[model samples]
Target: MTTPADTTAPPPRRALTAFAWFWVGAPLCWGLYELGVKAAQLFTG
Candidate 1:
């Protein structure tokens, strides 16, 4: 006799969450940092 097949889905991953956060957060933080660096130009003549 053969065994039954699994229909349940896999659990979420913390590593994948961290990786996704880093993927988005890194660029966001970098853009904010660059914006801050260049923000002075807005006030300058």
Candidate 2:
């Protein structure tokens, strides 16, 4: 009889995860900052 296959998945790499977040989070924060600046101007002006 043939053996059953392995079902478990591999764990993620920490460095790659952090690098991915940095690349993704920077632009997201910048967008939020710009939006806040616009909103402040809209309310104050």
Candidate 3:
């Protein structure tokens, strides 16, 4: 007997939720702020 074709749908994607985004983005924002302050000091000093 022939085998039947697969009919199941693909699995859902793993998306980044808001809480995860905040956790990841907070440090990045802090680093950018610090870099901007340092660059300003270099220009003024």
Candidate 4:
């Protein structure tokens, strides 16, 4: 029922999905934490 193209499509997509999540989430979380720390410093000082 399936073709060669169909079988190849999912693996690359799965790999890319995992890569994108790690790449985007790590920096976003770090930026949020850094911003929070800077905000606290401004308020306290």
Candidate 5:
């Protein structure tokens, strides 16, 4: 059976996993957006 010590432990590692995904995805998304804007400018010019 569980005990009080187990209850007192920190939250699980889900936040760390989420943050890792964000860390990898955010820059990739930003780069894609920047590239799209530049491509549009090239076509419009």
Candidate 6:
């Protein structure tokens, strides 16, 4: 019988993608939090 193809990405590539997303997402989350807090303060102060 013939073997099937390995269609998924390699481990190193997956790790790199995850690491890149973490770096990209973390700052966006922090910036959004900061904006939310500033807006709250502006309305309440």
Task: State which candidate has the highest lDDT.
Answer: 5
lDDT of 2 by residue, 1-45 (tens): 233457454554678879999999999999999999999997898
Per-residue accuracy of model 4 over 1-45 as CA lDDT, tens digit each: 333674544444667778999999999999999999998988898
Q: What tens-digit string does per-residue lDDT give for candidate 5 at 1-45?
A: 333575667566788879999999999999999999999987898
How many backbone clashes does every candidate have? 0, 0, 0, 0, 0, 0
- Of candidate 6, the 10-residue stretch with the lowest lDDT total is 1-10
Residue 43 lDDT, candidate 3, scale 0-100: 80
TM-score of model 2 vs. true structure: 0.65
Best by TM-score: 2
Candidate 4: the clashing residue pairs are none
Q: What is the C-alpha RMSD of each candidate to the true structure, in Å?
A: 8.5, 7.4, 9.0, 5.8, 6.9, 6.6
Instruction: Give lDDT tens digits, candidate 1, residues 1-45.
Output: 233457555555768889999999999999999998799788883
* Residue 36 displacement (Å), model 6: 0.7
Candidate 5: misplaced stretches above 4 Å? 1-12
Model 5 residue 14 CA deviation (Å) reads 1.9
Local accuracy by lDDT, each model: 0.81, 0.82, 0.75, 0.80, 0.85, 0.80
Which residue runs does candidate 2 get wrong by more than 4 Å? Answer: 1-12
| TM-score against truth, every candidate | 0.58, 0.65, 0.57, 0.50, 0.55, 0.57
Candidate 1 whole-model C-alpha lDDT, 0 to 1:
0.81
Q: Give the clash count for model 3.
A: 0
